[model samples]
Target: MSPVEPSTAKGAATRARLLDVAARVFAEKGYGAAKFSELISESGLTKGAFYFYFPSKAALARAVIDDQERRWVAEVQQRVLAQATPTQQLADVMPAMLELLAREPGAWSVVRLVRELGADAGLADDVVKPMDAWIALVAGIIRDGQQAREFRADLDADGLATVLVGAFDGIKGLVDSTSPEDREQRLTRYTGILGDMAFAELGILAHPRDL
Candidate 1:
């Protein structure tokens, strides 16, 4: 039989608590090293109760990843991309993401976990699906800017978006390693460079404050 969804408010709270603890555990220990006993201990839930919510470790990990991505897309990407201009949208994406990462270290942990285990576990493509969506979104914004003659039409929007995504991913590890304060500073500097490059590529004069 299929597992039942949490019915009562308390049941839903319990489930959310489990997911929260599980994300931190998986982040700290990685998928292979993370112990179910440790998770149970941290969550203050019995083995049977935990199993009722998540059948296995893999199930919990998948839930964590899905939750993190869904929240990010809804809260950050969708919200920022709703700006008046593609220029503003592009400018806002990195800073908004960095702020999210600062506030939600679990999101960073999920990213690291995916990079570490995704290939061996055959989950790499699945994990990067959200990134692909981001690329598409950025490309669409670039297309809009080009049509408005705000950005250069000669550049390939999709290719530029791919490069932008790759650069962001490459810098993520460095950001993850630093202290919280340092992470913010480094992210600001790196994203500033990104903003400058993007503006230069589009043949637009960036405001001094933007850089």
Candidate 2:
């Protein structure tokens, strides 16, 4: 038989399908328990076909991280951070990130996997590097705000970035414990207080709504 023709759309569809299934599998079984066979079966693809796209289970895990990060940066980060003021950008994006993680718990499984893998030097570098980059991005925005006088000149950008991102990490647990409506209300209150504190540290006067 002659070589099969490849359609770009079909290839894209396959990749999307695989990623979707992989998210579910990773969430259900976790990184250590997740299996390549299950992913292949869920994708309705042969082992060789799956390998052609992802190469290995470790590679697939990396793809999952990258896929989530890209969607997060595009949909959540861009929507908020693209605004005029860095403070406004962070304020808008912070709550949305909380809501997104709360709504899609499966999406946070990669975070759990990364944390679990942190003990391994090789895996830590792979996983932790992206996290550091995200933190660095946030720090950069804070620094910009300070330079513009949108934030206090004395503000500690790196420290503030760490606290801000660290605050959001605990949101998943809180969200899991409450009803969606209650979660929203509680998160609003929580974020409001956090915003107040953050602005206060920089000696900046901010309305609660600004956060």
Model 1 misplaced regions, further than 4 Å: 1-13, 177-181, 207-211
> Candidate 1 lDDT, tens digit per residue, 162-203?
999878877776676556567667877887787788778888
Which structure among the candidates has the greatest lDDT?
Answer: 1
Per-candidate Cα lDDT values, in order, are: 0.76, 0.70
lDDT of 2: 0.70
Q: Encode model 2's per-residue lDDT on 1-211: one tens digit a residue.
A: 1212236888877786787788778766777888788878888889888877887777777777667766775677667677778778766766666667667756756655665565567667776555665577678878988888887787679988888766655454455335556755677678777767766776677763655
TM-score of 2: 0.76
- Could you estimate the TM-score for every candidate? 0.82, 0.76
